[model samples]
Target: MLQSPVEFFRTLPKKVCPECGEHIQEQAESYLFECERCLANKEE
Candidate 1:
């Protein structure tokens, strides 16, 4: 059986940060940063 959006998001895999070794949550948006600190540091 297929899972719902809520279930999918709940079971989403997090990505690791290469710079500071942080786990980033899966976001619905396409253009996302690996970590908040990285994004704030202009890693985009």
Candidate 2:
């Protein structure tokens, strides 16, 4: 029996990295996402 990748990822929970403060979605999205700290640094 084979497990579907979609099914596997769907079961995972979203996590936010304290160091970066970015929300990591269980499923990937099209748009690029960055942490607030990273974004602020980019403006500098």
Candidate 3:
């Protein structure tokens, strides 16, 4: 089954981090995603 780009995005779960409950930032042309703050904290 094939789906349009708009429909694909519409079906995606809310862009949010499971760690800190912050909204995840959108990354263009990327399949993996994470909240900016949580990612930064992980580097510390």
Candidate 4:
């Protein structure tokens, strides 16, 4: 049985920070992507 694209993504792994190597939690309510690692690295 074939699943929908949305369903496929729901089962797929979530995005993570390439710098600190932390998971990037999704915040659909707000139109923003907050990356702790990237933010910290940017300050350096």
lDDT of 3 by residue, 1-44 (tens): 89999999889987777787777667787554667777788899
Candidate 1 RMSD computed on C-alpha atoms after optimal superposition onto the true structure: 3.6
Would you list the rank order by lDDT, best first? 3, 1, 4, 2
* Clashing pairs counted in every model: 0, 0, 0, 0
Screening candidate 2 with a backbone cut-off below 3 angstroms (N, C-alpha, C), the clashing residue pairs are: none
Q: Compare candidates 2 and 3 on TM-score and give the better one.
A: 3
Q: Of the pair 3 and 4, which is ahead by lDDT?
A: 3
- At residue 7, candidate 3 shows an lDDT of 100
Q: Rank candidates, TM-score, best first.
A: 4, 3, 1, 2
Predicted model with the maximum TM-score: 4
lDDT of 1 by residue, 1-44 (tens): 99999999778677787778898765666555558888788755
Error of 3 at 41 (Å): 1.0
The numbered model that scores best in lDDT is 3
Cα lDDT of model 2 by residue, 1-44, tens digit = 88899998778766664558678443455344655567678889
Candidate 4 lDDT over 1-44, as tens digits, reads 99999999789887776666677887766442447668866889
The per-model lDDT (C-alpha) reads 0.75, 0.65, 0.77, 0.72
Q: How close is candidate 1 to the true structure, as a TM-score?
A: 0.46
Which stretch of 10 consecutive residues in model 3 shows the poorest summed lDDT?
25-34
lDDT of 2 at 23: 88
